[model samples]
Target: MSRLTRTGQNVLTEAMMRIAVLGGTGLMGKLVVTAARDAGHDVVIAARSTGVDISTGMGMDAAFDGVDAVVDVSDHVTNNAKKAVAFFESAAENIAKAERKAGVKHHVLLSIVNCDDPRLKAFGYYQGKAAQERAVEASGIPFTILRSTQWFEFGEKTVSVMGFGPVALVPRMLSRPVAAKTVARSLLNCVEQGPSGRAADLAGPEDLEIPAMTRTILQRRGQRKLLIPISVPGAGKAMRSGALLPGPGSMSAGPTLEEWLSAR
Candidate 1:
């Protein structure tokens, strides 16, 4: 059954609780904050911009004050492997430290799917995420870990990351390309459920081929763009194998791609 169909005053009364989003300013964070607030939860937006840097522990003592649970969607923008490791490991340790001090109960997160699959992981991005999950699991606080598919916005961002002599090329990578809002809503449900210690992974209602989604966006933008899909060597292969797709009974019944686009 669809979660939305089951939602009502009863669900809201249960789901409406204090929840903090670590990277509330980011794309996924934005949707989570809005969705949680719409569901009647007391929401706190924590980020460097909001005076909370989890990695350095600056402003954390004050930021987590009275926070019921923490949803960490924070990310560092870096292709450098060492930096990724530092950010995630440090941030995980700090979150555990501050939460221990504050006595916060649950620490939820939106982690990438197949994070443990070595072949699909990029340098330290997956490794860092794995480290973070391990830290939280070892912390003994009730936690809910959600592995999610790639975001639709990621495709948009990937397209802009190229400057190959007036031509843009997509990494011959594969993705499920679920909407950010869908991911947000699913994570919120887990938050309201308290802590499940790694809940079921979530994906979109439809399986969208990355190349097709990219082409659709390009067409919508009125750019007669040439998108070259390159079969990347390592992690790319894992992604193509559907490592990020959700498992059975893991997805919420939500609007399909056409329905979502129409509503937007």
Candidate 2:
């Protein structure tokens, strides 16, 4: 049996592995790199900025050389379903090929919870995510997919993109938002545990309205805005009624939205 010890909120394992982090420059990606390094694991960052592009499969062979496992945190932010599907599918296919080439043992993907609900089929982003999941499953590689709820920072990102001076059209949806750092720690924990396919969903402690959360975020930034709740036909309608919420047996933890903001 392997020995384990607690370090703050993270569990450090005695068996360290050489890990390759795809999209290692993004918010979650950077956190994973830090956590892995802090836990004494060697990390290789595979990203376009580092000359490893997953889109066209360039520069991946060298990046995965001797990598014991691969963690994919690649993301494309878009509401256009076709575009989102294309991006994720391409990324998945390329990453799968590279993993096979490098003979990597384990593959981990960070995805969204409830992304495959029939109600969300019309939502382009979720549709894209579903496609990516299917690709990963068919890749013939040992893999684990950890689906998580939206992060607390999502409120800030929504406000930034949807805000128009004193008015913001926030999505009419519900979410259990966890901290991005917390999610990062969970991903690395999954990495150490090895491949287990479709790990338990990860969520935050509180159930919240998207618009209300965004409003609070705006207030924290000293911006008072007229928040209007807008609904879409399919996925948007589902989200308002908790379609995005985790099902039974999800792992819900927190530093809630307020607590996370205070810490920042």
Candidate 3:
């Protein structure tokens, strides 16, 4: 429970919360920690680098001590179905178990938009995210899920992953790339507002094609690589078909890809 006190003017005073960030050392996790701290909340960074492993449940007990909320931004970097599923399931279960014991009030998860879409069923990563959401839902803890579209960094990461020799293979995909900082702010909002169970999806201000994003990345980096637009099969095809875009009732933020790139 948040520490709130009513003042003489009948205005409630917001109490400082102690937030535990599961993937605190990672890109988005770091921003979340900073944002929480900047907002006068105490933050506990729980990550492998910080001597806590969520998948194995090691070091979680101490980290959750007196924690008001658990923000799980932990990520497993694998596209393999079995591995992704195993990792997310294990991590979510561990976090839930620990949170229950700690009597934490809120459980916040950062997931991908459209992860539950049928089109992404064949994608291992999306499957893992879906499974994670289910685990959190059944955890017996009050929870909120913030699903966000692809990050601006995804552009460069996709190019690097698909680059082969002088050519970069990219699927014809449409994505609204939001800035990580913007997403962090939204996560903090979820934390402050407590659990609302499946909050509105979060997306960027503008939608752009993947190949064009890749080209912009390459150009900005001064890398002259031939860009090949390839049609991906299965789930990749769904991704290219714009199934990942946020649906109605989503929350939109700024620092669009172009704006983010300019700032970078």
Q: lDDT of all the models against the reference?
A: 0.77, 0.89, 0.89
Which candidate number has the best TM-score? 2
How should the candidates be ordered by TM-score, best one leading?
2, 3, 1
Candidate 1 runs further than 4 Å off: 1-15, 163-166
Per-candidate TM-scores read 0.87, 0.92, 0.90
Give one digit per residue, the lDDT tens place, for model 1 in 67-93: 889999998766556777778878888
**Which residue runs does candidate 3 get wrong by more than 4 Å?**
1-12, 164-167
Q: What is the lDDT of residue 187 in candidate 1?
A: 85
Q: Any residue pairs clashing in model 1, and if so which?
A: 172-230
Overall local distance difference test of candidate 3: 0.89
> For residues 138-186, what per-residue lDDT tens digits would candidate 3 score against the true structure?
9899999999998877767777888888988877778777889999999
Residue-pair clashes per candidate: 1, 1, 0
Q: Considering summed lDDT, which 10 consecutive residues are worst modelled in model 2?
A: 1-10
Q: What is the C-alpha RMSD of each candidate to the true structure, in Å?
A: 4.0, 3.0, 3.2
lDDT measured at residue 68 in model 2 versus the true structure, 0 to 100: 88
Model 3 residue 97 lDDT score = 91
